[model samples]
Target: MSNTNSLTEHDHPSVLLPLLYESAGHLLSSAGALTGEQLRAASLLPGWTRAHVLVHLARGADSRVRLLTAARGGADLPQYPDESTREEEIRQGALRDADALRMDLETSLSGLLQAIGSHPDEAWDVPVRWLGGGRRPVRGVLWSLLRELEVHHVDLAASYTPADWPAAFTDRELRATVARLREDPAMPPVRISADGGTSDLSTSDRPGPLVRGAAAAILAWLTGRSDGAALTVDPPGALLPRVPAWRR
Candidate 1:
């Protein structure tokens, strides 16, 4: 799930940068609307509050910005120094008041978007080091940021949900998730048919269950954002295959 496809027009900054801005704007509006009590409430993510999710989103933007800067400077740098520091930072930042947290989210995302916008077109092809010791090009970083903003926006338990994701993003994300899970040993052996079978992928050569649903619904189920209740198994009354925790 940490990997990314080769750069294409789809991954170009011109396309993704605008989408990122729109996503961040929606997330900021949602964050700004949160009451102090709501901010303190637990998020969809286990053991993380709405404040924690917001803080993590803000920090994630900064981390990506750092990677882009490093790439531009011809220096390789991880998104963060280490995982412990990243977790601690999120924990500490989550304690801030709602107003401060919202401001931080807006500021960090705006700065990150600006950095991405200013990046030279050719620089986007330069590879950068990610936190998990993975190397992805600068365009990959942009895609990752978009994925973070859209998916974590839902994690905030705000108005945003998988259904609210743009068609392009949902399709691309479904493809990315499918590519990641296709060969994952932990994934269930099943044929996933999205959009009434317009798109299809199977984890095994042999037929198993044919799970069918809308693309967003399928992506949500695959990413652990929802139970597979919206999906239908081919065999009548067949149980949905259990999937391991989502890596993305």
Candidate 2:
């Protein structure tokens, strides 16, 4: 499991690198036995096949490598020319046979791991432009890749589920997600309680109904990976408030 202990305002690449490797290893190992038919099956994400998910994962790794390279004083490279190009790449790559897709993913993962591991200590603080035109430190890029691997591993919907997520990841992600939602102007006013109120947080300043559930379940719901059926709202079965769409 990845050590999410270092996931702070300013992350540490040394700490995050090991976790990234672990996450990638788990994802690759879990999907190792997928057949062509299985790869063609729809993933948890709407309209996305397992092959599409795998291709997207691989492409994301390559993009991170480009960012890391630029952070190391190399020529700046665009993660992609544009959003259409990215979607087209995923669409085209998903048409490959199972072995081809697996090999592409493995290669991309190895390349990214090498880039991160061999990065200079001083360069971690260097900022690089992300696909969305926002700048983040090399360390942030590492953390983003880690998140991608762990979350999309469950998205594959083969054997992994939210229940299999590491406790460190679940707790950290839930808190981080709540914190983000708190700042969303469009977010509904609601109090979120996890683990039967052991952990409670309000989404906005204004008070509203309380939605409570297990930590993993709450994280899954907040991330749009699952419906909130496992969660219960206060006011004696009042409908759960519609939360703003989660940002990936």
For model 1, residues 105-214, the per-residue Cα lDDT tens digits are 99999999899889887787788887877777767778888888888888988878899998888987887787777778888788888884346877777678998989
Candidate 1 clash pair list: none
Query: Pairing residues by index, what is the TM-score of model 1?
Result: 0.95
lDDT measured at residue 230 in model 2 versus the true structure, 0 to 100? 93
TM-scores, each model vs. reference: 0.95, 0.91
lDDT at position 17, candidate 2: 71
**Candidate 2 structure quality by residue, lDDT tens digits, 1-248:** 12233346446666667777888889998778788899999999888999999999999999889988898875677677678898999999999999999999999999999998888887876777777776666676676787788889989998888888877667767777778888788778889888843478888889899888888888888888788899898987688777677543
Model 2: how far residue 108 lies from native, Å: 0.8
lDDT for model 1 comes to 0.85
- Scored against the true structure, residue 162 in model 2 reaches a CA lDDT of 86
Poorly placed runs, candidate 2 (over 4 Å): 1-10, 196-198
